[model samples]
Structures are given as C-alpha cells and as structure tokens.
Target: MRRRGIDALTHRAVAEEAALPPQTVRAHLPTREDLWCAALQYTLTGWVRRGEEFIDRLPEPLTLEQAARAIVEVATVHPAEHADTTRATIAGVYERYIQSGRHPELRPLIGRYNVELTGLVARVLARHGRHVQPEIARAVLAVVDGTVVYRLAEGETPIPAAIRALEVAIPLLCPFPNDT
Candidate 1:
C-alpha cells in the first residue's frame, strides 16, 4: 500500500491487498486519513528507532560536524527504502504543523532530538571556532534538512552531496579560524 503511494490506497483496496476482510481492515483503520496517518506514524517510528540506534553507536561527545554528518547519513540511507511515502508523509506533517496552531505530541520528540543535535553543533563551534549562537545551530540544521528533502525528492541518496554541503555551511555559520 505504501510503496504505491497514498492515492493507490482505499480501505477496500488495502483490505484486498492484505487479504483481509474489508470489515477487519475498517476495524483497524476506520478512514483513509487513519490509514495514511498510521502508515506515516509507522514510518516515523522506524526513523526514530534508527536515529536512537545511531546515537547509541556514536562515541562520547560527538563533535558538531560528526553529529551533523551522522544525521545526514542516516536520513539518506533509510529514507531511500520508502522514499515516496515517507516524503509525502513528511510534507503532509509539515503542512499540518504550519497550518494548524495546535502542536502534535510528536513535536516534543522532534524538538528533543533536534536540541541534542544542535547542542552538539554549538559545542563544536564553541570549541573549534568563534562564539556559538543558537541561530547558527539552527541555520546548520535547516541546511541539512533542506538537503535531505532535496535528495529524497530527486530519488537520489547522495550522502557525499549532503556531507559536502554541511561541511561548507558549517564554516560559514561558525567561521573557523582558517576560513578568514
């Protein structure tokens, strides 16, 4: 159902595809929105799980560049598995988040993860370059997210492109001593 994209799915269609009775499918997913949300949430959970695993594998006190590179790499590698649905769902979620004033419960989860990532970046900036600022960390994150979205939309998983972009942007954001 997911591989074919959201348009290909209906309650009856999904039930048939799953070889389950329509009523049984309806019991689990009462509406098209429910099905899509479930699929998206499932995809998101997998992403979160992968991120946790990657964090666990990291050496203590990962530098900003290392953390950024790790995140880009993981996002690049995993999203290629379900690029279509995942991208669509991400677009949907971002739109919903922007359009509605209410925050989703998942917002905190995302914020916490981002805080950890940006904090690492800020630490690296403080240690290796000039003063670190919250805005600098945020700009770095925006670049990474934009790059990931672009690569996913192009049906390409170019880790090198992401890495290079981050490497270039990092200095601009932090302005290392040699950058001058």
Candidate 2:
C-alpha cells in the first residue's frame, strides 16, 4: 500500500509483496478493508513509536530552539534511513485521510492518529517551556503536514533541505524563545 495507491492494493499484490501464498493472505486479511485497516494501524503505530524515540533522545535541559528543531526533524526525516518508504507511507496515510471523508468507517482509526500527533507535538512544545495549547499543537501539525504535502507534490525538495527550512521556520511561526 505504501509504494502503490489503494486501487493497486489487492490480495494477490499483497501476497506477492509479502512473499506469501495468496491463500495465506486471504486467510489472514479476509477482506480488503481488513487488510487496509490493518496496514494503516501498523504504519501509524510505527510512526508513534519513532516519535517517542525521538523525544527520548532529546537533550536534557533542552532549549526551545533545540526542541523545535527536534520536533520538526521527527516530522520531516526518516530515522531508519528508509526515506523513500517513509514518504510512501506518508502518501498512503494522506490517501486514507482523504478517503475517510467519503468512507466514514476510517474516521476513528485516522482520528486517533490526528490526536496522537497533536499530543506528540504538544509534549515537545511543553518540554521547551511553551504553554501547551491544543490550537498551537494543531497549527504545528498543519504546518508540518502542509510542508510534507508540498514536498510530495513537487517531488523535488530534498528532505535535508526541507528539514533545515522547517527547523528555521518553526520558531518564526511559533516562537519559543530560549530563557536559558
């Protein structure tokens, strides 16, 4: 589902990708929705785990600037070096996010992701002494999501350059001046 869009996700395709028999895939997944929902859950759970690891690695007595950059970096960079795969995952998630509008059944699953992401950003901001607000967290997420979408749309912006740009832009857009 990451490399290809939803339309391309069929039992045979999934089985081929997994190097498993079609019968095995069908026995496990049962239906298309079951497979897609499971895939979404797996991808999102991985993302949340990575975000937590990034936060754990932040420096003690983290300055506002460092916190801001670290948070943006998590949003922008793929830590396991699977940048392309990560990009594909993001694209897949974005598709599901859009599909949820029409399908509705995907709402709770995708909505949990939105809530988790907002909470992750909010915790980072608060760690750096910012007064945590839901609006601020949502705004930060919006900027990150928009930046990522632009990167995907253009297919040109180098991830490193985009990461640097986001690090610089975050403080300007949502300043958290260092009191240290």
Candidate 3:
C-alpha cells in the first residue's frame, strides 16, 4: 500500500508482491477488509515501535521540546543509515494512518493507538523532570500529527516544520512546568 493506497491492496497483487499463491493470500486475509486492517495495523505498529525505541534512548529530565521532537521525529524518521529505504515505508505508514479514516471501524483502533501514544508521551515527560497533564500531552500529539500531515501534503519531511511548530505550541500549551 506504500506505492499506492489501500485501494490497490488486492489479494492477487499481494500474492504477486509476496511471491505467493493468490489462494494463500485469500486464506490468510479472508476478507478484503481484513487485509486492509492487517495492513493498517502493520503500518501503525511500525510507527509506534520506532517511537518506543527512540524514547528509550533518551536522557531523563526530558523537556517538552525534546518530547515533541521525539514524538514527531520517530513517526516519520529512520536513523541516518536507514533513511533511503525507510522514507517510503514511513510515507506509506503515514498515508495508511490517514486512509484509516475511511473505515469507521478503524477509528477506535486509531484512538486506542493515540491514547497509548499519548500516555507514553505523558509518562516519559513526567518520568524525567518535565511534566504535563494528559490533556496537554494529547494536544502535543495533535500538533505533531497535524504538522506531519501538513508537511506530507506539501511534499516535505515532517520533522523540521513539526519541531518549529512544537517550539511554538509547547510554550503555549505549558506556560510553566508542572512539578513532579
């Protein structure tokens, strides 16, 4: 679904891509929606996994900007060595994330991921020195995700503009640091 959208995810196409038989694809996916759901889950899982890995490497006492940077960066980025291949993968992931909106059943999955991600953000910030309420963490996510979508629409990478936006939003969202 990276080169195209979910519309292009046919059993035959997947079979061809996987070098497997069409019947095998059908047996696994069962329904077209199941195929789409699996594809969406894979994309979302990659995104979430990258974030988790990145945050684990960070130092404690993380600032809001650092948290925001980590959140936005991990969503669409790979380390310097992996950038070329991962760029398309990340784009596919982001596209699938937006495309999930077309299926109403997928929204709860999206919401659950968002809540888990937001909780991670809040926990990471609080675990270190920086602390923000869950509401603020969710707003921080909105800023990062919105900036990513905007940059993607403009054929730009999301990191730079997203960080610039967070520089602005972080202060607006948290005027004073909340005590741990």
Candidate 4:
C-alpha cells in the first residue's frame, strides 16, 4: 500500500505486484481487514526497522547534535532517492494511524507501533546521554507527526518540514542535555 492508501489494497493487486497467484494471497490474507492489517504491519515494521538500522550505523556514544539530527532524518523520506515512494509510505502510515479509531482490528497494531516508536525516541536521546521519560519521547513523536501532517496537507514535501520542525522541537522536548 505504499503507493495508495490501505483502501486500495487488494489480494489481486498484491498478488500481481508480488508475482504470486491470487489464491495464494487470499489464502494468506483471507479478508479485507486481514489485508489491511498485513499491509499496515509491513509498513510499521519497516519503519521500526529503519530506525534501528539507522541507529546501528551510527558510531557509539553519539554527540547530541548527531543524535538529534539522526532522529529527525532517520524515519522521514530520504530526499535524493525514492522520494515519491517514501512520501506515499509516510502518508499511508498516517492514514492507517488515523484509521485505528474507526477500525478496532487496527488498534493493536497502532499500539505496538507507538510503543516501538516511543522506545526509538528514547534510545536516540539516551545515545546523546540524555534520558527522558516516556512522555517526552512520545512528545518527540508528536512533533514529527504534527509537522508531517501539516506539510502533507499543504501539498508540500513532508520530510523537509519534518526535519526543520524536529530540529527546533526535539531539544525543547528533551528533559535536559548531558554535557558530555
């Protein structure tokens, strides 16, 4: 569902994209809700993986500025490559995130995502030698989510706006800075 919202996802479409028989796809997904959950799970898992991978690539004991910038840029779109695909994925995730209120089946997935994301934010802060409460980590997530939605609503590239907003907002969100 990277190129379209979850509403557009179908077993046939997925089968075609994956070059598998439609029956195989249906056997795995079974229903629209199943497909929706699977698609969302895939996207959400990728997002978490992206953050973990970014962190893995960093040198040990990151500087505050490095960790701050890494947290801002890690999960957002990479501007120079696969820009459209990244934008679509980001939009699709937000769309799924909002759908959790209407679709009870999706609430578990969203909850898991939020927990993982909260940990990611916290990890970035810890890497910079500043440990924060879970609420503060979630606030970091809130800033990025709000900025992304605003940019998307304005028909602009969300990544740049997210970067700009996070750079300003993250320091303020952290409880305190470690002088290391």
lDDT of every model, 2 decimals = 0.59, 0.69, 0.71, 0.75
- Write candidate 3's Cα lDDT for 1-180 as tens digits: 767898898999899999999999999999988888787777667767877887788777776667556666554545433433444555665665667788775676777777777877776556445568889888877887788677767777666677778778776776555421
Best by TM-score: 4
RMSD of each: 6.5, 3.9, 3.2, 3.1
Which regions of candidate 3 are displaced past 4 Å? 63-65, 77-91, 177-180
TM-score of 3: 0.80
Clashing residue pairs in all predictions, respectively, total: 0, 0, 1, 0
Which regions of candidate 2 are displaced past 4 Å?
A: 77-96, 99-103, 155-180
Q: Over the stretch 1-180, how does candidate 4's per-residue lDDT look in tens digits? A: 767766678999999999999999999889989998998898788888888877777776877556656665554623323444566556766777777787899899989988987888788778877788989888887887888788788877777566667667766777454522
lDDT of 1 by residue, 1-180 (tens): 335555565888878888999999889888776776565556555655665565556665556566556655444323333544455544443343332224354355455545655655455445444566778877876776787667757866445556668777876777756667
Clashing pairs in model 4, backbone N/Cα/C closer than 3 A: none
Pairwise TM-score winner, candidates 1 and 2: 2
Candidate that beats the other on TM-score, 2 or 4, i.e. the better one: 4
Model 4 TM-score on a 0 to 1 scale: 0.81
Candidate 2 least-lDDT 10 residues? 76-85
Off by over 4 Å in 1: 63-65, 77-138, 149-157, 174-180
